[model samples]
Target: MAIQRILAEETVSVTEMRKHPTDFFTDHPIAILNKNQTAGYMVGKELFETMVDLIRQLQPQESFTATFQPSVTHLKAVTKGSAEFLVKANKEELGDFVE
Candidate 1:
């Protein structure tokens, strides 16, 4: 899926994740989607980096694991634009958008 479309359709934000990490992960596994939205794979390093930043922001001294999830409400809030949803990638990372 196009990054823009993903941002438009699904809501994922640091605040939401921080609020209900467990629920969020349960509902949304970390994945990278192609521009066509047809294929996606589980993300590791990239997702880990993003989550680390989020966790640190919310709980500086707390350690987090990949199993965390966020609440449904928090997810909705992100999609609705109550919180900022960001997806950062360089041109190389965004190979799906090249064409």
Candidate 2:
């Protein structure tokens, strides 16, 4: 379910991207696409890093566990393999990673 939501959000963003003609970036559609993709990728990676840091600091002495709704424009949860957190949205709910 969570994955579906995330994908849906990504789809919506892509749809919006389609609506906006690639003419603003000096009429370079390819450049605009590449820039958007890079921006999204970097933002997701940065968010994951920040969350990991926060969890380490706030729960340094114990195992960290929590579910949060991020203010992400498109991407959804990025788990470091936790089996205890269950995210629900579309029709799928997965347990934390079990190792």
Candidate 3:
């Protein structure tokens, strides 16, 4: 099974959300998780765990959010430096996904 992740960076202001997005936050780079890409894929649970570990290893200070995909047995998260870490961890997993 192959798991996929897409990372998007956006500047979200306090007005965008009803509550504060972070405890002590700044307007720096933020990761946005997408589960739509994981739908209908035959990914495994271990793949998700591997991704989480790899992501945390890359950006220790960043916050990550995950959305489970019941349709595919996978999870997606919005985290910093995912593309760079994925390329270093598993080049094949990146497989032209990173630009």
Q: How accurate locally, in lDDT, is each candidate?
A: 0.51, 0.39, 0.45
Off by over 4 Å in 2: 1-14, 17-42, 64-99
Lowest-scoring 10 consecutive residues by lDDT in candidate 3?
34-43
Instruction: For model 1, state the Cα shift of residue 29 in Å.
Output: 4.4
What are the TM-scores, per candidate, against the unseen true structure?
A: 0.21, 0.22, 0.22
Candidate achieving the largest lDDT: 1
Cα-based RMSD of candidate 1: 20.1
Residue 86, candidate 3: alpha-carbon lDDT: 67
Q: How many clashing pairs does model 3 include?
A: 0
Each model's total of backbone clashes: 13, 5, 0
Q: What tens-digit string does per-residue lDDT give for candidate 2 at 1-99?
A: 132112112222444545764422221112222323422311234455776698788875767466865665433334522322543322345335433
Worst 10 residues of 2 by lDDT: 3-12
Instruction: Write model 3 residue lDDT over 1-99, tens digit each, in one string.
Output: 576543434433334322654432333333322333321222235655676689888875765666754543232333335655765776676678745
lDDT of 1 at 73: 91
Report the Cα lDDT for candidate 2: 0.39
Query: Which is the winner by lDDT between candidate 1 and candidate 2?
Result: 1
- State candidate 2's TM-score: 0.22
Error of 1 at 65 (Å): 23
